[model samples]
Target chain A: MTDVRVIEIKKSVFADNNEDAARLRSELKGRGTYLLNLMSSPGSGKTTTLIQLINRIKDKIKVAVMEADIDSDVDAIKIKDATGIESIQLHTGGMCHLDAEMTRQGLDNVSLDGTDLVILENVGNLVCPAEFDTGAVRNAMILSVPEGHDKPLKYPLMFSVCDLVIVNKIDVMPYFDFDLDKCSEYVHMRNPKARIIPICAKTGEGVDAVADWLLEEVYNWKH
Target chain B: MHELGIVFYIIRDVKQAAQENGVEHVNAVVMNIGEVSTIVPEYLTDCWRWAADKEEMLKGCELKINIIPAVTTCGDCGREYETVKYGKTCPHCNSANTWLLKGNEVEIKEIEV
Candidate 1:
């Protein structure tokens, strides 16, 4: 006599990354630090935002930054120069995104015991980062005015996947042909709950709101 | 593409599943890709072509992708609606008050091995 069996199977290709992100998430939460993954294009003012963020939030919060780039540690150096905070450059080599395993390694090198805010700056890419979860408590995206308001429509995944959206370069609105209302409409279309904060990272116009949000997240996470 | 790495993972999991099921070979892989997941189907297929050829059991297994539309429900009215392309706000009402109902998942639901 012979028997035939049917097997039920469910598998995930991102299992490895998921496990890494899960462990990393617990590690951050266990140590009482709010992790934010900041992602944007190459010239989308993420670094500038970091510089301004460091200037405002460093005194109020104990912060550490994990800067990811393709090759250079220039951004990390810039962050260090702006403030005396601990900054580590987490390079992804040639990879377009930062996965949970990479973020785990980055976190492993940092001390988040008394840290309040830890920001992981992902490589400057739109697509891949949206797909890979880095176990951040909040995934924030920076969209500059020059990148155009149509961005939310073009790269729906990047904008829709974010928890917070920083419409950077608002100060440039006067000089550039940017439509704030249209951009907001598109952003809300993709993610209705996404908090849209417009700012001019160049002139520090709306840095306070961002700092306030960061403080709130850290406060809520820690206390 | 991130799909290349994902393909490797799929191959590994399918191999284990086949071994446990006592199946000597895999015939097809059916996947449900989320619309807002930042995965390009073409790129994923291209990666699968190379990755699957590396495995003896999955050498010629057909790859099928079903794109799941990005959809959400309004928190205020509980009205489910299909996402209007890239813009996430509900079409019925211009309210930013929304929550993702489905369409951001990446999973390997079935494997014929």
Candidate 2:
């Protein structure tokens, strides 16, 4: 005779991810490697901003880029071709977002020794990416002017959890009906502690400020 | 979009639990899904149905989702309200000093055998 019984197991789906994230955070902290998880909507100029930032600070700090996408290595190719920096392409196998375990696996695949700053462009998503903590020291998000000012209201959790919010495409601000002040206001309403920086990736405008902020954080993470 | 991946995780965990408890087959898996979570419940079940059937223990197993309402608390007024309605600003006191109290969960609450 076959035995049948009811088993009650109460466990969180994210519990494993959270535990892995904490361990990764401690490991990165001990290694003095600062991980920045950058997120944004598609075509928000994340790659351009990363290229510009890498070009500006490559001489001072050791930088590595991890390009995560559902498929394709196009972003990784662009990063290597544009800046000649050490870059790794992580394919999530059709997953829209990368969790902590996935981040740890990607880190293991790459070389982080003597790497001061490791930037992960997290799947170019505003929703799923924000929901999972990837053991990053800082969560940075970009909101392009073309994406409009009401995005914070529409996607509150994404703006709320980010430590830094960058408003890109300021050079075309005149073309688009994007109000920088209004957008900043909405972001502040959602997360009062989030720092907002306005920049244009194509013109290389206001990128220095971002580099400066990053340098400060990396220095702090090390010391 | 990543619902299929999540289903994989669920299958792995459930299989482990069933093995530990000497369960031959799982009847149902109840998940606690928060209202504001990024996971779409319908997509999750669809993925579960397809993926769960592949495993021997989880074949014909049901996936039940319990949607939890999102709530926000006003820092100034000490009042709780629906997060989906008013967002960060508190409608009671009109204060922006509000924070989410709950409703970001993606957890497995129960497993039936």
Candidate 3:
């Protein structure tokens, strides 16, 4: 006789990831470490902006960058060459996204002792990265002006989950049809509490504002 | 793109659940996917077909996805509306003080043995 049964299990597929993220958050809180998950599209200038932000705030805070990619140490190399701060490269082994577990492992590999801020430059993809919480204190994303202003409607979830949205490459705003006001409106429509800043990473414009916000957030998290 | 990884996770969870319940084989697994989630259902199933077939317990098993509608609630006016339609602002009240009530879930809802 064959046995057949239907079991009703209401478990979140993200349950394990969420639990891991929560635990990571708690541990970081106890250690007074602020982790920021940075996400964006492939050509969003995340790396450049990160370098600028590090230059602005490295003097005030102990910062480390975890550069994640499908396969590359180029970002880690670049950050080390530019800022000389501790940087680690994470290869996802062909995975398009990094989850909480992976992020925790990366945290372990890096020397985070006495580290005030750990910035995870997540694999450049607006989709998969936003779906997983990497136990960061907050989530931020970079939206380059070349990516067009119609992104919010198409990728609402990414915009919805972010705490900060930086519009990069603003120096070329006159060249592109990217309307700052319209883009801000769209982002606000998706996330009312999200802070939107316009900047050009190439010229180092508005990078201080981003650093200021990061410092404030780190302070708030610690205190 | 990461659907294969998600499929692996689903298999791991299902296998664990089956072991806990002392089930011999899992016939199908059901997932609650949110409307705004990054997962694409078709790709998920496609990946499942490729990966699940390799596991003895999940061979020929079906993967079912239940999409949950994204909804947001207006704090000022206390009105609920479709998130995809109205986004952050409430269409009825035009309030920026709004939040997503549901629809960002990726969960295993059921297991058939």
True contacts kept of each: 0.58, 0.76, 0.84
Top candidate when judged by TM-score against the true structure: 2
In angstroms, the error of model 2 at A28 is 1.3
Candidate 2 CAPRI grade: medium
Q: What would the per-residue lDDT of candidate 1 be over residues A1-223, giving only the tens digit for each residue? A: 4353434565556776778788888878888988999999889999899889888988888999999997989989999888888999987777788888888889888887788888999999888898788999999999998889899888877887898899998887877889989998898877778988999898999888989988888898877
Off by over 4 Å in 3: A1-3, B69-103
Docking class of 1: acceptable
Could you give candidate 2's per-residue lDDT for residues B49-81 as a string of tens digits? 999999999999999999999999998999999
List the TM-score for candidate 2's chain B. 0.94
What are the models' TM-scores? 0.82, 0.95, 0.92
Stretches of candidate 2 above 4 Å error?
A1-6
Q: What TM-score describes the B chain of model 3?
A: 0.94
Clashing pairs in 1: A188-B89, A189-B87, A189-B88, A189-B89, A190-B87, A190-B88
Candidate 2, residue B37: Cα displacement in angstroms equals: 1.7
RMSD after CA superposition, every candidate: 3.9, 2.0, 2.3
* Docking quality (DockQ) for each candidate: 0.45, 0.68, 0.69
